[model samples]
Target: MFKVGYFYTDCLVPMVGNNPYATTEDSAAELSINAEVYSLPSRKLVVLQLRSIFIKYKSKPFCEKLLSWVKSSNCARVIVLSSSHSYHCNDLQLCSCPFRYLLTPSMPKNVQNKIKSLNWKEMEKSQCIPGIEDSEFCVRIPGGGITKVLYKESSSREIPMMVLLKFVSEGDNIPDALSLVEYLNEWLQIIKPSVNDSTLSALPWKIPSSWKLLFGSGLPPALF
Candidate 1:
């Protein structure tokens, strides 16, 4: 979706690590920077792609700086795509859809109503003290790095923000990624379904070449 001519390089977040590595072949050739921003003027949308993991104890500060930048840019809203640990799901969560969304209280009512119309499940609050039935309930997102903090900060600042997340485990996450995108499309309508296939989107998503070796190089023939 962020192809050249469609999206232009906007800015970079320099608060991440100094690894200076690329996550994909396209990025290796065109972008070597860590947190890069791309903008699609036609849609008035900005996408921040983080290519590296954040350093320990820096998530809050990074989120603060990010929100500050958003405010300065005068963006209408923020949508965060993230994932949590499927293993941490509760009984109710396991029985329902693995996808969930969270909206800041400050989000526009119209947008909230639209989301509600889709019947999307909101992220549920878990017991603050695990195993304690009477303990207070709070939002819990295990394995969702920085998502919880970012949501809280955005709410406190009254920034219109939405978070879409999936429950997944450690492994090839390509399918999980596709599922999340489809979920987001339900709200954004970025890709319209074809008349021939009402269940499928018009555009076919191609897996990036970089993911060919996602599980690692083929086993050495010598080993067999």
Candidate 2:
């Protein structure tokens, strides 16, 4: 969805390694060490894509800075696409849909009502201490990386934000990604389905060429 745009360098920083050369085979001539931003002015959308994992201790600071930037940019709202470990889901979670959503308290009531109309499930609070029936419940996302932190920060800062995530296992997450996008489309209506096709399955989506070798190039024939 965020294939084309000029580089947004304001928030760019060397948060990861300092290697000047591209470390992976799929990357272009230069390395990707900073978060990238893509703007779709026609649609008034700005996508901030984090290319690398944040250093463990820098997660909170990064989220704080990101929220500050959002406020300064005067963006109407923020939507985060994330995932969680399917294996970590509780019994109730496993029985229902794998998709879930969260909205900051400051989100507009109309938007909240819209989500409700879609009949989406909210991220469930898990036991703070596992195996203890009476343990306090708290929001936990085992493999969600910075999702929880970012959500909490956005809530406390009163920045209208929404989180859409899915329960997925490791490996081949392309289908999961497509499903999440479809879920988001139900609310954003970024792409409208045909009148004959009420479902999003027929929506025209162009996958970027860069995704060709997503997992990596094929092994050399010489190796065989």
Local distance difference test, per candidate? Answer: 0.80, 0.79
User: Which 10 residues in a row give candidate 1 its minimum summed lDDT?
Assistant: 3-12
Runs of candidate 1 exceeding 4 Å displacement: 1-28, 199-203
Superposed model 2: Cα runs more than 4 Å off: 1-33, 197-200, 219-224
Give the clashing residue pairs of candidate 2, or none.
none
What is model 2's C-alpha RMSD?
4.7
Candidate 2 residue-wise lDDT, 89-140, digit = tens = 8889999999999999999999999999999999988888989999999888
- For model 2, what is the C-alpha lDDT against the true structure? 0.79
**Cα lDDT for residue 119, candidate 1:** 99
Residue 96, model 1: lDDT of 96
Alpha-carbon shift of residue 36 in model 2 (angstroms): 1.2
Displacement of residue 82 (Cα, Å) in model 1 is 0.8
lDDT measured at residue 104 in model 1 versus the true structure, 0 to 100: 98
